[model samples]
Target: MLVLGIVLFALGLMFSIAWHELGHFLAARRFGVRVPEFMVGFGPTIFSRQRGETSFGIKAVPLGGYIRMIGMIPPAPGQRIGRSRRSGPFQGLIDDVRADSVKDFRPGDEDRQFWTRKPWQRIVVMFAGPFMNLILAAVLFLIVLVGFGIPTAQPVVQSVSKCVVPASQATTTTDCPPGAPPTPAAQAGFQAGDRIVSFDGRSYDSWEDMQLAIRASSGTVPVVVERPEPNGAARTLTLYPQLIETQLLDLDAARTSGEPRYVSGSFLGLSPIQPVTRQTPEQVAGYVGEMAQRAVTSILALPSKVPALFGAVFLGEQRDVNGPVSVVGVSVLGGEVLASNNAVASEIATMLQLLAAVNVSLFLLNLLPILPLDGGHILPALWEGAKKRIARLRGRPDPGPVDMAKLMPIAYGFAIVIMLYGGLVILADIVNPIKLNL
Candidate 1:
């Protein structure tokens, strides 16, 4: 089962890579850019087939993918293709990149080159890859939220606490401390599986409403619960339980600070059962929006986590559960999820959510505006367009497309950093994997 889960996740990852590259391929084709190859993964081609002018294929390494479009970098001003007189290390690197950019150049294919396209067209082609990932993430989130549902706390009682414990002294253990006061619900004979029908003489539709009512009330109150009988029948019972003031979470303050905040409220000591509940489209949209924001924040914090990642890999430090993970780590997590003794729907939903998160991460990471990223290409194109616009407004000669060849050295450097960081993450994943608490 573990191997099967890993294989399934690996296939999903490959499909996501292909989907991302497909966006670039389709957008490039739309703008008349000659894409000679559209392949998933990297390294030696494992399978390929020619379709029209494009050779679509899969490669040995399922790490990343790309679409090869002709003339990615414009030639140096007043210089012919494949010709460079500059003699320096950076110049040599730039020249090499320029040469590869036009390696597939053919007669009468000048207009089909990617650099010849308008700035907006070029931007569309480059941005399409990340946009596809965002779309996939949203769709997967919708499927999981609407189809499989999300775990929600219901009004049904899962357990009843024996004694009152203050919110500030919260602990995992349910054991009552010596001389602790007995909870109202326990005194009222509340049992697990009892569904709260009404509280304080008021019928509530949701757990939140019941909680608010409980907090607002004081002294002995009539609480109604529908308890199941031995004959599969349910009977309503009204029990007078004295509500006591205790510390409870302040949801509004917690939302602002992203940390627990507490205030005094009436305590009943009833723990709600969590059941899977389907959500509306609006709810799903809000959920995905929040997920995207968190993903962006995580990407921004990635650099700070590298030292800790190395510690986990080399110093035998504990791996942070919320820390960065590589593709290999995610696959292992999927395997653990599948091999666990969980319900089938729950496992499937968890896997889909994991894939959605991966897509969200891909969507944000590719938009970092660093060299070799989609945003890197996009920024230059926008600058070129702005320069042309400014030149026309000032009655000056139009500036040609930005010279991307000049940025090749920086791009190469960034690529190296990315590779090293990825390697470190992989090593950490292998040595000190973050296991699921389940």
Candidate 2:
């Protein structure tokens, strides 16, 4: 059953990718751009056909799909224009789309080529996939919002992360959240949703401090808290401390930076407060973005953030080399997420949003002022634009295109690095397949 669920989820994700590409195809065709071929895989065509002006087909691999717009990839000096591929709908149009960017490009035409379109239009074409993704995400969120509205939980502060709390609380905070800090011998006296402000005689700004104070209690001691009652009224509750184990980090391992180590012992009973349901898109986006940004920033800042980077050279953190997740990871996550949704619309919407985010990021990243990337190409264009005026003043011919070839090495290097990292991730997955935990 679990395996079936995983398969179902994977299929759903593939559909989403197909839909994202379709968005671009549909738009390009609508704009009269010539679309040559639209395919659902990367390698050579296993099944194909030319229908009307477009050729369509499915490939042996189901992992990815693409719509080949004539002139999408810059035609080398002499390639033909307005070409397309269209096959069949035997398995149904798993992927179909709006427009062909080549519609504007005719044989021996440059000014009307995609490259000739206003930069804004070019950007739009490049960005549309991701744009659709964001929209899809919003729609999914809407469904989730209207269906099973997120519920709110008691605002009791019981758990704190090891990074958030003082070393002393390390022993107890686990129970404060989902993990058990301690049971019978030191069961949590507080409830799951209890709001603990000041425990024992110590005033703590964090659960860490609170935990330390409690562990330090060592015996029955009175604790006070401001908690919300079942009727929505606020009240005070007092509890006594029970004996519990504590958490402590090893100085040597902690110094490694690469290997953060912590030791925790049982604590008096303590479970975390309940988590509330998400209520708004703003709330979801804010929280999600915050988490994503922080995670990204933390990884990037790890070297500076860790004092013993020099000593930790041999020890590496969770091989986050892929800078978090590779495409495989995203697809896996998406598969798991979209699989359970009975509603195809909601699933598609969610999947589209994910796709949008990916494409938008791709487009933006490509536009960065660097060589070999579209950004690199654009940078030269910018410089050439300015240089044209200077050349006109100096009565010199305009230096067109500014030799983009120079960036080839840089682009190749970047591509290799990405490929290597991706290979490593793929290897890891093959050696130890990741389970869909959802």
Candidate 3:
């Protein structure tokens, strides 16, 4: 099952890559840009077949993919066909870049070249790929949040803690020390499966409301719960649960840390039941919006996590679960999700969430305004548009397209850095993979 899940995930990734490239391919064709090839993955071609003006194929490496559009970069001014000259050290590299940019030149393709299109059209062609990823992410998020339902914290108790541990020494293990005090929940005879109905004469439907009430209480509070009897009758139980000052899990700061930060709060040792509940369309949209914000924030914080990533790999420190991951790591997680003892529904929901996350990452990663990315290409188009507008305003001749070949050095450097980062992440993933407790 795990192997099957990994294979399925790999296939999904391939589909995503192909879908992204297809967006660019279609948009380029729409804008009259001649596309020579539409390939998924990179490196040496595994198999290829020419259809019409385009060659379609997969490649040896599945790291990334692209569609080869004719004349992505504009030629140097005063440059002619079949001309080859190297001015200086870096000039040869620039010349090679500009030359290869138009190597697919056909007789009639001169006018259909990408650089010949309007700035808006070029922008649309470059933006289409990332837009496809965003669309996929939104669709998947809706499926998981509305169709399968989202896992929600309910006012039902799943378990009661056995003892109260000091905030400074708190751990996940429930093994109590000798002579440790009993938790308020245990002392009040709070058992598993009890549904919290009210606290301090206040009725609450959600666990969050009940939790706040507990945290704000400084003394014993009137607690009303609906407990199910073995005979199937529901009986009301009222116990003054003396709220104790103990360590509470800081939910906001606990995401990236292995050990949750403990803060003093009125502790009720009952764990809320996480029930899968469907959300409305508006609710799902809000959820996706929040996720998109978080995704953007994570991408921005990625560079800062490099040191931690290295420390975790070389210094034997625990790796943060929210740290960067390569495709290998994601595939391993998919396998782990399938191999877990969770129900089929739970597993499917988890995998769907994972896929949505992958799509979101894809969208954000490609949107980085650096060379070789979709956003990178969009930048030049925008600049050209601005330049043309300014030219018209000054009543001068319109300038040609931005010479993207000039940015090749920086693009090459950025590409190398990205490759190195990916290599490090892949190595870290293999050495210290995140173990998810389902």
Top candidate (TM-score):
3
Q: Indicate the residue-level lDDT of 56 in model 3.
A: 99
Candidate 2 runs further than 4 Å off: 23-33, 47-52, 72-111, 145-153, 156-188, 192-269, 275-278, 291-399, 402-410, 435-438
Give the Cα-based TM-score of candidate 2 against the true structure: 0.57
What C-alpha lDDT do the candidate models reach, one value each?
Answer: 0.86, 0.49, 0.82
lDDT of 3 at 266: 76
Best by lDDT: 1
For 120-141, candidate 1 gives per-residue lDDT tens digits of 9999999999999989999999
Worst 10 residues of 2 by lDDT: 90-99
**Consecutive 10-residue window with the lowest summed lDDT within model 1:** 248-257
Candidate 3 Cα misplacement greater than 4 A, ranges: 81-89, 166-172, 209-220, 230-262
* Global Cα lDDT for candidate 2: 0.49
Candidate 1 clashing pairs, residues 3+ apart or interchain: none
RMSD of 2: 10.7
Q: How many clashes does each candidate structure show, in the order listed?
A: 0, 51, 0
